[model samples]
Target: MKTDGAEVLSKTVTQDEAAILDAWNVALLEGTSLQSGRIREAELQTQVKTVFGQLRDALASGGLDADAAGFASLRETLADISRSRAIQGFTPTDTANFVFSLKEPIFDALKRMPDGDATALAAGVWAAGKVLDRLGLQTMEVFLASREEVIGRQGQEIAELSTPVVRLWDGILALPLIGTLDSARTGVVMENLLQAIVDEEAEIAIIDITGVPTVDTLVAQHLLKTVAAARLMGADCIVSGIRPQIAQTMVHLGVELNVVSKATLADAFAVALKRTGRKVVRQQASTEGRR
Candidate 1:
């Protein structure tokens, strides 16, 4: 009895081999059926070579393609066998590189399909692309999240020391203040100063106005809280970069700042040094007329 083309293509040494061969056949047929040309010249040439080689071997072994269906079956079976053998020899890294290299060919294959098949093929490719993109984004996000966790943990370590933000003169630390506060960033101001004080064991903290845009009653309260907190921690929180408008608003609001030591950044630093027992002694010159 003579075996038909489909039967010949379907034959295997074992059931497991048959299953593997069948799966490869399906994948090759599905992947290449709509592709233009025999194979993509750049990346898929190896696949082409493998398939052609296998077909030659099969032909020499007396495999016959009796009809169009039989011919297609033989062609796909050969392609599958070739692709599988080629992949089998690849190391994991090589496999990854190979896949990466195949991206263009894969895309081209989808683009060249017949109109009826194009939509379905394109849709499948698009879906696959989306899944891959999402997976890549998630991977990057996870990596960044992990890095943030490490930085946070490091921050907690320093925070444990209760070091104030003032010490940052010798280093850099970003303070991201969020939400509305009464007294115009007073508490945060104080907390940052005190943290600086403890951390740097410094006499001055530059109280930043970048975060505070207004001076309402609540703003004043918070500022007072910050000042008080700084004093208690033995740090002079220097209010810096006060906008002219904000200062006017403070005056109009009639908020007394007597209890809170005030200065433009420079004066604040001078005051800070004074409070920390560092005085700037001035030298007086004697008049020549006395001689």
Candidate 2:
């Protein structure tokens, strides 16, 4: 029977699995940060073994296409490795080297084939290169996707953290704005303020933008949206942080906040206090003070 290149290659790798795995490990350590202790020796060994074992099986089954049903398990394994490496802060090149590193060992094994299959060298090397390249590309794709997911989730977390709604009193809440207030931040601002309103049963929300450097038409529109959302939730809103420059800009832009506006967070808070039927009275000196 005439054994094909893939069959011959698979047989060679299976027969020299131990030696091939060692060579693969050496290649990975030399080319990657596996020694920096991101991944333990045992885990690294296991990963190499799993990938090689699957590769051998898939090649034997003529499953070279990465998307083929026969290679599904192998693709899943690669994806898992990619995601793990991505979370470990591995660079894209390092993550891909996990598969590409195996190329040296595999090709070395191919060259050592006995005279009987020596004629299979060219074909075997070509097939092996194509398959490994496909798998390496797959690993890179998954790594990038995992990194994107991590970034998007972290971005949302930071947005929420940046927009904190504090309870100033029993019926009043304050959302102190800082930095630029764009549409995206406005949405975050609105959600946080509304949720706090329900959570604190707040009747008034003071949006203190004293930290806001300037107010543009768009910024004003965003503020109006937030105020509208709060009003719909039965909570009145106060726009604070008005400066000489900002007040002038709003006037020229014909931007009407409609709700009460204050010059500072303290002014907004004081309004919040009185409207909530609360006050801050200073204690007078007693006989102890006189003594």
Best by lDDT: 2
lDDT of 2 by residue, 94-129 (tens): 888889988888889888877646558877787788
Worst 10 residues of 1 by lDDT: 6-15
Indicate which candidate wins on TM-score: 2
Report the lDDT of model 2 for residue 100. 90
Per-residue accuracy of model 1 over 114-184 as CA lDDT, tens digit each:
44354455453553354223323333343444456666877556443432342334322223233345432
Model 2 RMSD vs true structure:
3.4
lDDT of model 1, residue 135: 28
Candidate 2 clashing pairs, residues 3+ apart or interchain: none
Task: Give per-model TM-scores.
Answer: 0.35, 0.87
